[model samples]
Target: MADREDKNAENVAGKFYVDSQCIDCDLCRETAPKNFTRADDEGYSFVYKQPESDEEREQCIEAMEGCPVEAIGNDGED
Candidate 1:
């Protein structure tokens, strides 16, 4: 059960959630395509996968750093 929960959370990916604070800047997608994607309807960015490679992990960290609104993080736990 705990493993399942962890998997579910990993599937959701990232520590950040796009909120009303998002400006649809697409920076996250640009920084990490494998991890972040644009939502079709909302045009906001979301994490598609937890980064597996060093490069990808760096990309996600960069996306978080580059967020204009600082909307990205470990779901505010950071």
Candidate 2:
């Protein structure tokens, strides 16, 4: 599970975030390109935008579920 305390600083203030456990995988990026992005220097993924629509929300959820390291978290502000 992703630790909110350890969430990446690059992540915007939102429900979806990526923690330190992230392994630089492209899964979230591929699954939710609009909401998630790569921190090239850090080699980790972080949530850049909160979902603005049902489709975007679903995509973020899919990315969270597909994360192999369980680095994605959604228990945040709505």
Top-lDDT candidate index: 2
- Tell me the tens digit of each residue's lDDT in model 2 across 21-55: 99987999999999999999989999999999999
Residue pairs with backbone atoms closer than 3 Å in model 2 (clashes): none
lDDT of 1 by residue, 1-78 (tens): 012222222236444444445567989888888887766676566666767788987887888788887656554332
* Alpha-carbon TM-score of each model against the true structure: 0.70, 0.96
* Model 1 steric clash pairs: 15-73, 15-74, 15-75
RMSD of 1: 7.1
Quote model 1's TM-score.
0.70
User: What shift in Å separates residue 39 of candidate 2 from its native position after superposition?
Assistant: 0.5
Give the range of the ten consecutive residues with the poorest summed lDDT in model 1: 1-10
RMSD of 2: 0.7
